[model samples]
Target: MKVVETVSGIRETLANMRTAPGKRLKVGFVPTMGYLHEGHQSLLSKAKAECDIVVLSIFVNPLQFGPNEDFDKYPRDSERDLRLAEQSGCDVVFMPSVQEMYPNPIRTSVSVKGVTERLCGASRPGHFDGVAAVVLKLFHIVQPDKAYFGLKDAQQVAVISQMVSDLNVPVDIVPCPILREADGLAMSSRNVYLSAEERREALVLSKALGMAERLAQEEGLTFEALRNKIEGEIRSTPLADIDYIEVLSYPELEPVDPSMETVSRTSDMIVALAVKFGKTRLIDNVILHRK
Candidate 1:
């Protein structure tokens, strides 16, 4: 696999590859912030299975992080990431630097409303704005027919999907299933931030979500009651600090009213969690589908 750094080089390379005689390449793209893991590999593997060529971009987008968030300290291993990408059948690796991507000061950005108003968006102001901007940039750069994302960031997937539909960007957004650790903690690049004890405590996020899903399935609990129960479970873990626990509709992420009582059997709901274990904050969600 070839590693391209400059914007012009990647564009030129892709253009050339497209022009190859008798070769029709259906390109699939996976945009990541590096620190490759099984979650990322799942995306690559899916892309490889469905596309003629797969491209993975690893640039720690400064736009996606808040001023107080861990941008500088975010874990990165380009050499290791490249190895993982190549091993995962990535045809090309676009490892651009911040300077290369921005070139000059960025005066513009992209965003989707309603969907960005709650959960992570409300918790971290302007977070989705950065995500939308960088994602659009990568979408433009890669120009893939299909781009993959993990369903772990359900809100993010929703926002990006809405943006593509609204803006008429000609790329398919494919959300792969969330990959989890054996202990049920949602896999994240930030997972590396947790200490051993904090890591063990982190399981509460998933455990609570699992319980919420089961309750929605069998117990027919009210939205408010389910959310409160999930929050109570997380709080039970002394090491877990709750950031937000929300029960919202799928894709739209519209708030499920507290007074709505029980959910219909056919309703789709996402139970999302954001909790801090020590200095590391992790997010996890479980989508309850009609049985």
Candidate 2:
């Protein structure tokens, strides 16, 4: 229930806790924008279970969103987020303002070269750079023993992992499973933009992934064939416009060559898709182990 608005305030509070503590306090941190949802709650619940203290940060990072993107309209409810964080067992809520986090112009950013070149990165230029910079800043600010991120943003997870390893950030980056709605839509704060019809159309992303999974599992289909099928499914939905459909090697995320049978046999594949429903872009993916 305690909300610390300034960065200095958070630092002071944590310092006091560190000095008074008998044992070294293990803190788990979940950094997010201020919209509380079941997906975020899932992360907090896991953090609470594992760590002695849980810190949830609710700052709508302006740097992460492009000029045309929804930075201004991004849903924010600090009061609601605070209550939910408290209910989910978070000890401290860090709600720093834009000015507080970015006092002067930022010069440097963390960027993972290969992984940041495809999927979401391909479409949105400088998106991952912004994500990397803000996340690094948050890690420095919170200085938690462990930090948690949802797997819904698979590429983001990969990028962050790479940054942490390269930079030697002294925290464990724990990736939790993707939380989905009962209807199978991957939970997202941006899901609010979907209207009644667009909402129905949005399911195509997951459905296409399901089709790819079936093909990969049952038909013993090649990566190219499976990717084609996924793309076909998305195109079939009138409201859906395909952005990118790729089956890449897991973790490294390099595009797999299905023509080379040996590559398919040796590699674990991941099918990832990004499609635009009207103006809202949605992403979904499924991982398959080649037999």
Candidate 3:
């Protein structure tokens, strides 16, 4: 129920949390840009169940946005988000200003190689560097014992996991399941920008991924065949413009070669897709793990 705007204030509060006499509380952090939804609520719900104190930080990090990206236009509603956070069982909400986080004009950034070379990383360029930098800053600021992220942004999750592992960040990175609409569209803040018609078309992203998953379960379907089928499904929708339809190894995110025997029915894989419906770009994914 407490809201802290300044980094120092939150740090001081968190310090008290650790040193407070009697019970030592376990902190869980969920870092996000403001506009709250069912997906974000799902993360907080999980965090609340697992940790004693849940810290939700709502800062639309400029560091993670490209020059021409939607940082300025990104949807934000802190009042509503704050209410939702409290309802979702958040103990504190950290809402910091851009200037406060970057008082001196940022000159440093974090990056993880290999994992950042494909999918959203390749398309956005320097996007993961911004994400890594901002996340590290938040992780330091919140000082949570565990940080929660959703599986919808699988690439982002992979990048963060890699950064945490490589740098030995002392926190558990917990990824929750992707929460979808009743119609199967993955929830996103940008979903607000979609026109009514575009919203309908956007379901193709999930539908295609569903097809990919089904194909993966069938015998004799190569990686290429599954990818091609998924791509075809997206292209069939008049409003959907393909950004990227990729089938890659999970966590590692390396593209799966069709000729490789490792890509058979029993292989673990991720089907990721990004599509543009008019000016709104949306991303979704499905993880395949068959025994």
Question: Can you tell me which runs of candidate 3 are displaced by over 4 Å?
Answer: 261-266
- The positional error of residue 274 in candidate 2, measured at the CA in angstroms, is 1.3
Q: What tens-digit string does per-residue lDDT give for candidate 1 at 136-173?
A: 99999989999999999999999999999999999999
lDDT of 3 at 266: 54
Worst 10 residues of 1 by lDDT: 258-267
- Clash pairs, candidate 1, are none
Native RMSD of candidate 2 (Å): 1.7
**Least accurate 10 contiguous residues by lDDT in model 2:** 258-267
Model 2 lDDT per residue over 1-291, tens place: 578989889988877766644678888999998687898999999999999888999989888888999889887777778888889998999999899999998988767899999998998899999999999998888899999998778888889999999989999999887777888898888888888999998888877777777676664456667777777878888998888888888778887666554323566777888888877888877777767
Model 1, global lDDT: 0.90
User: For model 3, how does the per-residue alpha-carbon lDDT over 53-114 read when each residue is reduced to its tens digit?
Assistant: 89999999887788999999999999999999999999999999999899998888688999
Cα lDDT, all candidates: 0.90, 0.84, 0.89
In angstroms, the error of model 3 at 278 is: 0.2
How close to the true structure is residue 223 of candidate 2, measured as C-alpha lDDT? 67
TM-score of 1: 0.97
Q: How many backbone collisions does model 3 have?
A: 0
